[model samples]
Target chain A: MRDASRAASGRKVCLLTGAAGILGATFCRRWRHEYDICAVYRGGRLQVPTQEEWFIDPLSPHAALRENDNPVFAVKSNLREPAEVQRVVDLALARFGRIDLVVNAAVHVDRDRLTSLASSSDLLDETFAVNATLPIQLAAIVCRQFWQHSRQDNQAWGRNVINLSSMASLGVVAGVGLSAYSASKAALNMLTAHLAAELAPIGVRANVLAPTSFPQLVPTSLVADTVVDLDRSDLTGCIVQLDENGLRETPSAPSALHF
Target chain B: MTMPEPRTLQAVNDLQPLLQARRWRWRATPFPHIVAENVFVPDVQEELARDFRTLYDQRTTAGYNTQHDFLGTSLISTQCGSLEVFISPAWYALFTRLFGINEPGFLTAGVHRHRPGSRNGFPHNDIFPERLDVGPGRGDVLRFGGPVAGKSVRAVAILYYLNNGPWAPGDGGETSLYWDWKDGVDTPVDSVPPRDNTLFAFSCNPHSYHSFRTNRKRRDSVISFVYRGVDDYVQLWGDEGLRQYAEYGRHHA
Candidate 1:
């Protein structure tokens, strides 16, 4: 049994997108002990509830762990709107006082049957906007407003932005119907790489986690643990892939173009 | 001109814990300065912002340069009386404690309204060679009296931003800090936007070069300077080097 109020102050705060999704909820439930999660969702409701009911059995081995306290803050905001994005960041900062990590787990998959025929320009645009553009926008506002001038000395506060990517982005999944989805996720990967390169000097990390498939080959808990590991490691500008063989990393190539 | 609302003693007392809890960590690079975010609590922040908007809408006059206009008030404007009476001593004590100054000091404060699209201003450090007609008492302001002997040295400068609305990226009113005036206005070591209820302050030195960036919208802030007497000035940079530094600032300004 953990005390929620007491533990919240010492725990790092994570602003997680896609809280209603499987991976996002799992991450929240699993790491709610280590972090106070600001769970963000657009459509569906976040499934994790507070510690109201407890399943205690005297005969069970894990009976001592029956009592629980959840430290998840749920917020509904459409990331497509820049104003909504700013509001979400502001609310999180107001509640938690600081956000040490950002998890971009929100995804958009085009459902139009005509997407395979390359006829859905609007669908592609919306998908790209949500997946690629929104992440950068959120990153920019949070970095500028929340981080401020305090991180100037390159102090490793473990401040990071982690994007959940699909293996389809890496061309491992082949389907004409998934073209828009794959392209947008790939753009996110590259954008994360660029963001990582730019923010490295300031001691802020950005990386991507490319899973072969959620809950299919990779268990959701493994993916969550991998996020924690990636955040803890010194690695930046690398794509860590999860598959049957376990995690493998591919470092991003250095860019020749300088601003 | 419509008058601004005054900040009450109750407001200052309400903000005491927040200000006390804030760690005034001074950074040394570019220049010695401290940046404090969320400087006031929500209600006080809102009230101060409203007062600034009232003053800007009614009282501001034509600017000295094309870059910014002025609202030349006393050491503290009667409109925002609590800023000097109740709030400024907090800052004065903090700066003096940080610098370990044991002697007496004074402050000069005014409101500045930078016009939108007015981007062409030279970088300057506010260390003029002229003597401050005001004496060594707290809250004394420069009255610009007839020729006096010694220089009035500025020890610290603080800018409290009081914008009420949201400040977007493209609607840029940023206080650009530079490593040196030779670096030009384009290359700033750091650019602090005029965010609502934020405070940016720096020690006054020869290398403390700063200027405004292109503001797509109007920029408003309360600018205040903490000063020490001529003895401290002569000790820092002898009487001889005063004119040289002043000339350098004048040439750039």
Candidate 2:
């Protein structure tokens, strides 16, 4: 860690996953001025402005991620492991002293249809683990931390968790082979709703931004602007779709059919 | 003011054979519905479109609440001069001849406007079997309890599109006929584009599920529902009609 004392300097912190991805990098660049960002990347290095200090392994004793005067702190950690996930939260708190926002942008897509059955059980499990389960786990940890920290400080500010989702969650896109991808995204949407309901009393809002299409990919600036819009609004438990037309709130998922 | 013009009368007459030919095909589908183009004379269509636009602008300026959820668009109930055409005897005769009804009781009529980003209406039947007692002076509503409920009566729903301009081919806002509700196989079996001067109609049965796609552009239409019995008045207007009648009672007394 560079300096725990430096982290105490007041600045709203944003913990962004998949910071190396297109959307994630764009968000970091645009939001760096307004927020102290803890950019967590798993695979490659992100080219955003960052502090000189780097923490190789979050689990190790010497692993102390710190944010100096620089607005971004790049922490490389595998989010699949529970220990590593917890470490990212710890690093954010230790570096920035507070996490005001968490953007779960990491997604895994497996293009296998139910009819083909070519996707192995292991692949399906990994897909769900990365796409849905890990995000939920990260959200639970952040919510708990916010609750504990607010109780300690006796002050509550608006906190937010924006889950990057796709329209595949609503239904299977034609010829997209989205059996696993759709199921996982649908699970993420449900998770977002549950989080919104559970965390409302604590001033933490959760929502999903699902884009309708990725033709040439959705503009990163649009996604960033939507995130800022959702963060500033009181809207929660909503799955807003970003398309060429504009943003629209999708209807809630139907209740399960009982036999 | 008077009966429909000769050309408008002829237009109504021309619709009978086309509707008859498709009656069996529409009824055989999961939901019963028919879409007919050129339902009105060109001049009459232009007049209705102009009146609809004027009324829509006036109502929207007066701050009418948008019904984006169930009705699939914003509605304006205030009558306009163009609506007189629907109440004309020629219209009644056309409906009577087309559907083979002895006497058609006009339930209600209204105009609706759907702007962009206002799509995705869940599938639903227009009439239900539930009854609402509207106290004294107001009649009770007897909902359509499907075919099996011997006490139930049928109603006809008609939607006349007035989107009098060119639209993109893939642009949505088409009226969709579905087999069932949201949770069922939601793929629409038939989708009727909101083309100018086109009309879509169906009998309000249990399986007569219909909804509209979100309007990619502006779409305007006039909807009229007709039933065989006066009981449907309560179904169409609901509590608002009762309230109006109560106000009338207060004023007259």
Candidate 3:
């Protein structure tokens, strides 16, 4: 609703992750014009059909929802793969000229906290993947490809990494079987801070979405709304949330969710 | 470097009459948009899940958050069934024409078997984003969702099935999509009869009223899903998954 065209102009193309998700989907829809969108997501998962069925993007689920007549190639692959990650960056550059904004909208949910001894492996793997490892990997890859490491640590401009971390990364929702899950998110918070400090010098911003949905689940689309604001706000290293008022909200607690 | 596939919008355009009929009710909406569509694909694999009973074993007053409807856990699990009742390539193809593209989907789906004799959910638009970008006079999407009374353009509720049998007329598992009351008038919308492995959708927003009757006779089962266009993708893609997955996020130690 707010006019951000002035701020949006002259920015380099954007590179997005988790494009098929509710948050990712919403982001692509609302912010497609703000930047030349380069959306990504996990590939080849069998999506249960909805009306969304007709628009499957062959590359990734997020890419499947684009409305532009412009050709959006679905680079079918996973973010976990370093080689695959590198390939995605290359694809973006080949399509556009350069990448400006990097939004980490990708997330994997693991819910077996008080899981049985028999299910501990599942719990551990899920926790690690959802909690810490993926974000770390994403940051590493983005830094290698996009960051201008030679810039002053404090005064970098026009570059940022909007990571999709969670409120779980900060506090407790008190759900059953959530010990590992909670611990993992908490670790993500620390990772965000570390990455933010390290990435600051490279003229890149790193922020997280530490939402406080105590008795309920917040939508990924809500998080995407925050990313759309990047064109206007000085929200570098900030984590935004979709609050009760149907608008993007700031974290009640100081530390946001993603790096 | 690798090339990615072009993303396309899956506009649910086969729904002209069904949608148009409802749109006839509103003169204020510039244009109405179908924000969600989930069809039950029949002839697919099926299962019977007892997770709902397990979840509700000791937890009563089942409403969990801001959008609580009834007082009990409303959940269930359905096993494999036919794809005939679920969506087919034909329906999907129709969606393509509406959306102007071909979007691929899969054959696997689960079921929501509400607890036996459970009360229906309180009336609400299924997808509510924490932040809606809609404003006055843009269209119907900005005006949809909530218990009632606010301006909402959402007009249909689509329910698909897990099996190939007809639900008894008295199964009590009807859906309510619209309801209203005032000093001078009162109207309510309700769910159509239950069917096995089939997809039935309708509107219940602003003017298209509807609701689901309680399931008191036989078990109430549904292979639930929803859809939206590229315009409303964020609301669906962003917030819709939490309907089930996020609950798993909140478990006690």
- Per-model CA lDDT versus the true structure: 0.68, 0.63, 0.45
Docking quality level of the chain pair in candidate 3: incorrect
Quality class of the docking in candidate 2, CAPRI style: incorrect
Winning model by TM-score:
1
Off by over 4 Å in 3: A1-8, A43-73, A114-122, A149-157, A213-221, A239-242, A245-259, B1-253
- Candidate 2: give the clashing pairs: B119-B214
Q: Write the per-residue lDDT of candidate 3 for residues A191-217, one digit (tens) a residue.
A: 666676677556565656655552255
lDDT of 1 at B128: 62
Q: After superposition, how far is residue A21 of candidate 3 from its true place, in Å?
A: 1.7
| Candidate 1 chain A, run of 10 with poorest lDDT | A52-61
Model 3: lDDT equals 0.45
Local error of candidate 3 at B190, Å?
34
Candidate 1 lDDT over residue span A1-259, tens digit each: 1111211235678999988898888888888878888888885445454321222221121334423456478787888875999999999999888887888999898855443457547877888888898887788788888775656422345677889888888984544577778889999999999998877666677888888886888798898888888766656788888887888887655651111
Per-residue lDDT over B172-248 for candidate 1, one digit per residue giving the tens place of the 0 to 100 score:
77888877766788777667778877778877777777877877887878777777776776787566445545666
lDDT of 2 by residue, B1-253 (tens): 2224423533344333222122111233555455566655566677778877777666644333343432222231345665555544445455544455554343445676676667476566665432322234432221122222222233677788885487665777788777655433237755778988777777665567677787677777777655554344344435443343344334323
- Docking verdict class for candidate 1: incorrect
Clash count, one per candidate = 1, 1, 90
Between candidates 1 and 3, which one is better according to TM-score?
1
